[model samples]
Target chain A: AQSVAQPEDQVNVAEGNPLTVKCTYSVSGNPYLFWYVQYPNRGLQFLLKYITGDNLVKGSYGFEAEFNKSQTPFHLKKPSALVSDSALYFCAVREGSDNYGQNFVFGPGTRLSVLP
Target chain B: DARVTQTPRHKVTEMGQEVTMRCQPILGHNTVFWYRQTMMQGLELLAYFRNRAPLDDSGMPKDRFSAEMPDATLATLKIQPSEPRDSAVYFCASGTGHMNTEAFFGQGTRLTVV
Candidate 1:
């Protein structure tokens, strides 16, 4: 089974400060990881994905994530937080070898609050 | 930009009533997925289709829930007898059906069963 976890239920950060939303995964094989953001009353928007590439993956809205195989973690990061960046973040994972179902297991989600 | 579109942005119904949600996938996408979102469960895959064929539906309750892709572009999820516990936001996403491809999500339909 492939699963992902977002340890923090909520994260508070100040504007202009760096922010990190933690994520970890457990999969039987290599993992295809993804990051998504959801604003209140809006659909989830894809931020980025780590299929197989360099460890560092940059995404939309000045966001990036680093894939650490040894640590089984893919943490979303931003150099500077903004009030608009406050939203719910989700981490998802799928087994690299899974082609039949193409189902993704999503984390419970972490609510990020960027105080201005 | 191409995106998946779901109908009935919000639906409120009394218990035991049938509810149906529809989705239109992006053109040329071969795979479509239905998911339920709630505070407790987050996002869970209810069903999915590939090439207009049902691939997996294990996450959905078999008794009252049914999903079907009537054509290449249209998909529908039906609940015969909705209950209060079934209240949640249902989302539809479409992808190319290739390994590692990202799925584009619809705005979702918020269903409330009383």
Candidate 2:
């Protein structure tokens, strides 16, 4: 089975400070990780994805995530936070493409509040 | 931008009435997914189709819920005799279903069952 866990339900950070939203996963085969952000009354927007590449992958809005195979973690990070950056973050995991089929699992989500 | 398109951005219906949601996936995309989002349950996959073929619908309620892909671009989800519990924001997403591809999402249909 494939699963995703976002340990924090909420995270608060001051403006211009670095922000980190934690994510971990468990999958039977190689994992494909993704990060998405959702604002009120809007759809989930893709931030970034990790297929197979360097440990660190940069994405939109100056956001980046580091893929750690040993730790099974793909933590979303930002060098500086903005008040507009506040939104709900979701971590999703899918099993590597193969002959088998499994549902994509999404984490419970973490609400980020960037205080000014 | 090229994205998934969903019809009837908002719908309100009485209990026991039938509700239908439609989606048009992105061009050349082979995979389509239907998901329901709520405060309590979060996001739950209702069904998905690949190449206009029904692949997995186990996540949906078999008795009252039905999903089908009439063509490569058109996918539909129907719920007969809907209950208040069925009220939620339903989203449609599209992907290539190939290696290392990310899915694009629609604005979603907010269904309120009164």
Candidate 3:
């Protein structure tokens, strides 16, 4: 089975400070990781993805994530947080097995609060 | 901007009533996905379509849920005799190609079954 875990239910960070939302996964094969953000009453917005590339991948709204195969993690990061950055962050992994189908397993989510 | 669009931003209805949610994918995208979101289950993929063909719908309840893409532009998810547990935000996403590609999402339809 493929699964993802977001250890933190919520994260607090000050505006202009660096923020990190942790994510880890368990998969049998190579993983395709993705990060998405959702604001209140809105649909999820894609942040970035790591399929097969450099360890670090940059995404929209000054966000980025680093894929660590050995660590089994793909944590999202932003150097400078903004008050508007407060939202729900989700980490998802596409299962690599053929029988697992082409569905994404999303983490429980982590609420990010960027304080001003 | 080219983005996915969903109808009925909010719907509140009594239980046992029929409910329908609609989505319009991006013009050139070939893949469409339906998902349900709740606090307990973050985002569950209810169904997906590739080239107007049903690819996977294992996440949907076979008894009351049905999804179909009558045309490339429109997709619908219908729940007959919906239950209170069916209340949640349902989202529609579209991707250009495969799972490896990015999928854009709509604002989602908030369904509240009482």
lDDT per residue as tens, model 2, B90-112: 99998888647788889999999
Give the local distance difference test score of model 3.
0.90
Q: Which ten residues in a row have the lowest lDDT in candidate 2 chain B?
A: B96-105
Q: Estimate, for each residue in B1-114, the C-alpha lDDT of model 3 and write its tens digit.
A: 898999999999999999999999999988888999987877899998888888889999989999999999999999998999999999999887555777889999999999
Candidate 1: true contacts recovered, fraction: 0.55
Better of 2 and 3 by DockQ: 2
Fnat scores for every prediction: 0.55, 0.48, 0.60
Model 1 chain B weakest lDDT span, ten residues long: B95-104
- Supply DockQ values for each candidate: 0.63, 0.56, 0.52
Clashing pairs in 2: none
- The whole-model lDDT of each prediction reads 0.92, 0.91, 0.90
Please state the CAPRI-style docking class of candidate 1.
Answer: medium
Query: Alpha-carbon interface RMSD of model 1?
Result: 1.9
The i-RMS of every model, in angstroms, reads 1.9, 2.4, 3.3
Q: For candidate 3, what's the RMSD? A: 2.0
Off by over 4 Å in 2: A97-102
